[model samples]
Target: MEFKYSDNDQLSVSSTREKIQEEVFNAKCRVLTEIRECGQLCDVQIRVGEESFPTHRVILSASSPYFRAMFTNSQFVDPNQQVIQLEQVSADTIRSIIRYAYTQQCDISTENVESLLVAADYFNIVGLLSECCQFLASQLSAENCIGIEKFASWYACSELEQIAHNFFMENFVEIYRTSEEFLHLEPENLCRVIASDDLNVKSEEIAFDAIIHWVDFDPIGRTCYMAKLLGCLRLGLFSTYFFVEKVKEHRYVKDNTACRPLIIETLKFLCDLDRYADARSLGNFDISSCMLTPRMPHGILFVFGGWNVNSPTNIIETYDIRSDSWMSCQTAESDYRAYHGTCVLDGLIYIIGGFDGMEYFNSVICFDPVKQIWLEVAPMYSKRCYVSAVILGGHIYAMGGSDGHTRQSTAERYDKNRNQWSFIQPMHQQRSDASATILDGNIYICGGFDGVTILNSAEFYTPEIDQWTLITPMLTPRSGIRVLTYKNTIYAIGGFNGVIRLNTIERYNEKSKAWEPGPEMSTARSNFAIEILDDTIYAMGGFNGHSTISSVEYFDIDNEQWYGAADLNVRRSALSACVLKGLPNAKSYVPSRSRVPIMDASDTVHLKDT
Candidate 1:
């Protein structure tokens, strides 16, 4: 026998289920209110200091494992006992904990969270303890992170400890300089923080200063561990000027007998860079742990130039992938320009021509993150808007774009030695709003609009031959698209195909000499910025035909799925982005573009200017 239902029966059944849920919710609210107001059915009295709380044993037992064990275990205290004395917890904390037991809600504030956490931990109230930890974790900053980390570590709250630890590492320099908590860190904790390679301080000079300050805080008590702490600082990262002028003559360094040999060895290593290898082998210290490296593997992604809702914006922001946070860069007044072409060379970012709402630009600017300065570079041969630029063979190649009047087939290259731009062999077809990337020593440029129509045509410039060679066209004609090289394959991401905004993506495999369909993006975006970090391609901020979007998403190569990342601070379109490696002040070097075996397409097509 089978049961069947009509449309009316199904509706009636759904209505009944919703009604039952509402009634159950109402009953729960009534029971919680009665427990708070009447307290007539409370079977147990919890005494803390001079105050006593009336609560039911069943609610307490259900809310906490410690209470459950105390009430249920025959070998422990009897469940029939009328009152239980809690000597460790305070009266206010006990009341808050009991109130949470009955209502599953309690106020957690800066003043009360610590005491509540202690009582919650003692009673094995995991939920309440978690709430307290989360509240404290959110309140973490440069000033309070050290204390929170220590507290979380002592209480065995691993999640909270990690959160506080990350904050401390990210802001080590400022915290060491300003936080009173930093001066109070225990020797072991201080050593651990100093030893971490993830510290984001500008130089080892700050680390050395931090060590000195710690010792000076309690000289007699910390003097014995001076050598141990000094061993953890990356002294090699400090400049010779700092070592000779500041550190060498410090009373702490000169007075400490055990630390003298370490200082001498560091100076010797600095004098003869080759001696670093030998010193590492001879010294018992872990050399790798004391070496300075990038805090983030692929560095940070800089998002530059885009149109806000009302108009073009010169705002520049950097996204820290590790922290999943955005920070504004201290850019110069001239740095406010959008719709520009961007490429990273010699650890420097080059911003090329674009429209800034009022005037089109042919000017170029170079940003040296290490120096934290932006310098106006040699202007391009012709003013271009919607251009694409890429670095190949130590020279930056500016590809086709509109000069605000005509779509140009002309290309140019910049010579760093002369600090000038010179015209190069022009493309066969005039195009604008295209994208370019370098692979196998050749520059690949793909899909954009000619003066008449959108294009699917693709081509490459061979430096050896010094000529542009046309390649297989894309599956769909698109302009304002973003192309990225990853894992030896080229991905063309989302774009507008003249009629509609597209989320479609495609990839080019050189071995097959063909374009293959790839995964589509979550949003149909155009003129967005795209960057590849650690094999994942992030698509951020673009126009979806009707409006600019601040949303960002990434495609995981291994999983073959798209997931959302943090949104930008402002909605934007026609933005540019690139990854910069290492902290500022580290030695500058061009980052190698290596790839794992993965293919992804998350392009941004150009939407026709409204």
Candidate 2:
């Protein structure tokens, strides 16, 4: 504690000398810091074998520890001394060496990578040597792999030499995107880099850039790659109008010439978008058109009949929303029949009680569009045509059909699960060709000609009570009219009142138990197809009394009016209509709007294009 000033000065001098010595040593091992342009103030000399190389000549960050260490003892043998000179190696060559040494503690830069790699082979830095081998393998080129192999073999870097040989052997044909100082590889390594899964490039620009490289640069090799990218984009999930408008507003001009592959991929993506958009709406198929059979409470639209002058219309004709076209489906029916009762439940279409133009059919035919098969179920209690079949509480309620002799007050129930029919309480009046629809879990049967005359009385049947209750009468007595359900309300469109073909339209509210007039059809037609698709009521091909017309019309329930649609592909009534299927997760069932599988003629008729 009582040291003299002279002793303190001597101690300070010793400490300064030690600091100077430490700085000198550190500078020797890190002389490249001088190149950083004043970032480091240390002065040092770097020894490379017998020569000193100034690091200030290289352009690199002075703060980089790697840059500092690279120049400290960088060396290669000289011909004069039988040692290699690593300074003679090109930047491209050093890249391979540096990359190899990075994974190991060994220096793999041109000056040290090869020598350390050789040392690793002899000194058994197994993991270190292994990293060098992988580096050499990764950097192998078609023109240089053999030379690298030869060098590795001479230096006893057997693993490195083998790696180089294997790399070139497997990836000799790889195409690489190259720059003056960089190389982005193709094929295997490129796939691995782009598909690394750990890459965090979330920007669309970067992702699209990567995608373009794969798609445009090597289309044949990147088919699956582009497909996966498009799938991920799922461009269709975006609203079409919004996407199109955005693209137009941005004036995004694609590189058509250079981006042919990208353009193709984009087009495919757009197509998928349109397709799925339509498919999404199919599940909500509410209304399309309606038609009437010849019997009461049972008279529903017979949708399987239509005639085309240009082609034999054996297929089903459907209403197309986009084009307003009547798409003819020649395969709607397995057998030629009209005046049939059609009902939908659990995605299956059940056709019951129709005339095949030859005989009154009592057999219940169930058509499955998914399976493309038709099954026959138990016959009704009495053979009925113009019979009403309504689905309530998981059972089909069959009411009133004639046996070509007399209309009966008959009612029966068909259990879907059991595939059996049981007798139910009959109606009060003997009625046939009656329009019936289910409302509030009750069957409402209206207006049909009894055996003697056209009856105006309507009745409601309760499945729970197994009884029919007489309800209010319609404004007009009509038979062979079409009935539809929309938003908890029922609508009757077009009918014959014994003396005239009427275009009158009526709406019924179950709550009020009354019928009211709505918009009438443009054409006064009878025996027409009226259906519901897309929640709108469509009036399809029907007879106008003078000739069979191809006129088609649709009703706007919200607007409470009818508008013109595409005419039927053919001009025949007594036809039926149903929806089509779509891909999984698809919305609408229309094939035109969706990317549906291309169906052949045979398969075309079997599928329901919802």
Candidate 3:
């Protein structure tokens, strides 16, 4: 391609390409496989477990460094010798390995992957080894991750080992309860796992329970390790009642005199917290002790890029539920997006259509929480601000929003695999500043401003039918309302009602098909970021009629009332938020051990001298 300028200058603008398609590569591979099958120019016989596999020495030597050294170096092999015997691997595994060497394809399954990986490692076949490890890594579950991690590490498959280790720690509770291999873990590896800062447990009780179970599995050999494992827990985080009643009186602690000092330290820590409960303010207390350092959170709520005082903000913050604190994440300088739509899919956060204060955007940016990077993806077909988005059936639906000039009834569906967005059925009404959520295999979008008036109308879209149907209207007119589905029920919270901001809450009664009253927030807000974590709906920064505010609060099902939580670091409105679960590098998003502070003025609790 050539670019012509008005000044009579021209330049070539093109990308050079040199590549072969998969089918083309496979065609060449098929020739190698066919010749090997025909025994054409065969040079070697690999014998394993009562079976002999004929092969070409050149193919084998090219595919594996082990074979290369054996065939090339006189010190390793004799030129006259044609047969090599392998007793470590079965004939089936050897056959698969030979096939892969010829065709770059291997048949791997759960039953054979482990043994196949051993054969690949022994033979130094990097490609086959990688495929085997990848197969095992994909099959990692709580029940088998510990064994897989150990297996990968023993073979020096560093990438697979790291992934397995991350999964093992992130799902520690599940593995602890379900994995037989965890109970049989060696003391050193067990200590390493439990002591990692990456350990993910909502509470320290799970870690303590794991210790008891692992010790109980082998008391004779593990009794001495009781203190070592016990020391790894954040004992200070345990409730006073639970600590004194359960931990203090447990046989593991009572029977071992070596555990006496740890118990005393925890008691002192609890006593100090109780003593300072009333006297010390949140930030004044020293909370840098190892016993108080929080583990990696099971989930992290991200609040990023919002409309601030006079313009869009470039700020991004993470709320760590376990630590009950917010830490500002250091992100690359990016376009500040406001009124954006956010959806997390397959551990990646997608920031959809938004406004950058100057223009509405159809562009999309994907955030990799694991690698802490940003990338541009395919954009939407229509420019949108105040967009409402939801991920359903693995497809992201960007619903009605303003295109800067007017309210839009247009919608589109994004295919992550194709990096493309195609048209979807528009809503019944043009809506802006609406909220959308997934409930019962359908996408429900609630109240929003339709340019002329704030709307109380609500509707749902069924992907199977590709149509929208009107539902019951809200009890009050609302714009910028936050609607979410929790435990099969839909709750619509704070928003503006044209004349003023509203603090009221109403829930949709599905059977009755009407909006019922729920608890109201303390302060009225609109255009806020809301998400559910630990069974609580947390609402973050939003507009409070006159100005943007940093206040945050929550409403829990068990209490049936609203309660305040820690506020955000920035005051902003029109923000987008989502929670990412089971992130491998969650520790990077959260504050380190030294930076974690136990209390803040926004959220303080009293310890009743227990």
Candidate 4:
């Protein structure tokens, strides 16, 4: 079709703007090639340490503001000059800078990064300086973070300094133990590191040891700063035994006159746990602000296998209560198993019987968090699912669950000393999906289905007598309930009441032998995991009837309110969870000499058919 043109008509046009950009890029490439290969067009000579680099002054002037100022203003050198000498930077570094000016690219390695960064900053090359900062930031590690942070601060590289400082804080434990630079830290920097609540240490004992190590390395020189450094440690968090055996016994504490008052204050604080507020005022340091409280040790909550929306899963994840973050942990070496029972004893997590969709399992497994590995342990006597296991009197009591064919009232206890499971006196009632918690030296089992009906009956077992006695029943009959002991009171969290999912919560007072109403959960759920960290009860992912959920909420005992926390990465139900004391440190594990099948995040292990 032919178009007629009119004065009022407008038309849109498409143009190849990229072609013009390509032509400009080609011209720049040709100029760089000529300067590099022929050097005939070179108008400036940069002389450094017995070597010289010849390049066009126009390229250098455009790439760096320093060069531009020198050439345009003729401040120190004439634009017509053919050679300039730089004594501060080496020849190799000067050549690299010139190459970057001409080609807009340069290689930075560990050997040359420091020198190159210095030259870039000196020449006022913003792009090269940024590149060097980014490279150094990416290379920050426990071994090199101190040096990088110091260098970045000296050079006024604020972004690089902050990055290096954060890495140093997060990995301070390893750096303190292994890095030579830690001993050489300036007094101010050393105090700042020790004072930080974000330092991931297993305990204040580790931090104290680190301070002592630093002082002992150069005792005479560091003795002057002993009071200042020791003041930063959270001495109140240490036990009385540690203070007596480690702190008071140390030479530094005895020799330093300035440290006596601080030690006395710590002793007073330990004697009276309620003296933190008063001590803080007197000492000018807030003992209450310490990350590890006097009551609860630093720990991570490990959540094990559960059923996802579509199927069961053997995935594991950990929650760092201090950081309030969840990280994927090593998975288990078996088919997806939910309704499993778990308890921590002697630094090992023992996983007991549970269902795996098609069959009830009596199999038991042990997980070493440090080694990040799982090992098979002695299996239980009966095929059980939906069991409740608790560590009482140094033995694992695996109680009431279905055996695929029948609900079990049978029970067994595994003695770690004997490394075997032995039959224990059975409960009065058969129960599955029940909850068990230890209180006042007795194991209390409460609220579960008996394969016939949901029961409200609760019982406590005396290990010495090998007998179970009925206790006060709950207000409501529940299955899949979670029982936890806090402040000597038993809390029954959300669960199913056979008719509907429940948000109702109740507490049992062992001394009074009574059940009292408690604050309800935000959502009604069953088959979830509950853990008490620092007096707050966290209820994580579970089935709400129609679908599995990833939502998590914590019940603050002080405020008597429920608030949301971070959600799980996967929606699941019937998971097992427990809090293991100590900071999460993968390097703490001693490597096993014997070959054992280990399961990691990237790999899965299948159980051998027996």
Best by lDDT: 3
Please give the lDDT score at residue 380 for candidate 3. 94
| Cα lDDT of model 4 by residue, 1-610, tens digit | 1112222112111124656777798798777867566877778788887888877778889899988887787778986788988888888888888888877789999999999898898988999999999999989888999999999998889999988987887677779888999989888988988887556564577778788878878988998888888888867566666677788778888867998888887777666544433332334433334422321224567788888876788778876553345666533333478988999999888889998788889988887777666767678999879999999878999999988889989899997755679999999999999999999899999999999899899999999999999999999999989998888899998888878888889999877899999998989999999988645788999988778998888887767778777788778999988877653563122112121111111221111111
Q: What is candidate 3's CA lDDT for residue 83? A: 94
Q: Kindly report which residue stretches of model 4 are placed more than 4 angstroms away from their true locations once superposed.
A: 1-297, 330-335, 583-610
Q: Which structure among the candidates has the greatest TM-score?
A: 3
Question: How many pairs collide in each candidate, listed in order?
Answer: 5, 61, 0, 0
lDDT of 3 at 381: 89
lDDT of each: 0.79, 0.55, 0.84, 0.79
Candidate 1 has an lDDT of 0.79
* Model 2 misplaced stretches (Cα beyond 4 Å): 1-302, 306-314, 330-332, 579-610
- Kindly give the stretch of ten consecutive residues in candidate 3 with the minimal lDDT sum: 7-16
Model 4 clash pairs are none
Q: What are the RMSD figures for all models against the true structure? A: 21.6, 29.0, 5.3, 21.3
TM-score of 3: 0.83
Those runs of model 1 whose alpha carbons end farther than 4 Å from true positions after fitting are: 1-298, 330-334, 585-610
lDDT of 3 by residue, 1-610 (tens): 1111122122111111223466678899999899989999899899986789889988988888988998888888888789988778788988998898888889899889888888899989989899998898899999889888888889999999999998898778778888898988999998988888778766777788888889999788888988888888888788777788889899878878989998998887787776654423545555677787887677888888898889999788989877777888875334598999999888888889899889899988887777667777788989999999999989989999999898998889998766679998889999999999888899999999899989999999999999999999999989989999998899999899988888999899888899998888988999999999756788998999999999988776776767777778889999988998877577777777676656422234322221
Give the clash total for candidate 1.
5
- How should the candidates be ordered by TM-score, best one leading? 3, 4, 1, 2
True-vs-predicted CA distance for residue 324, candidate 3, Å: 2.1
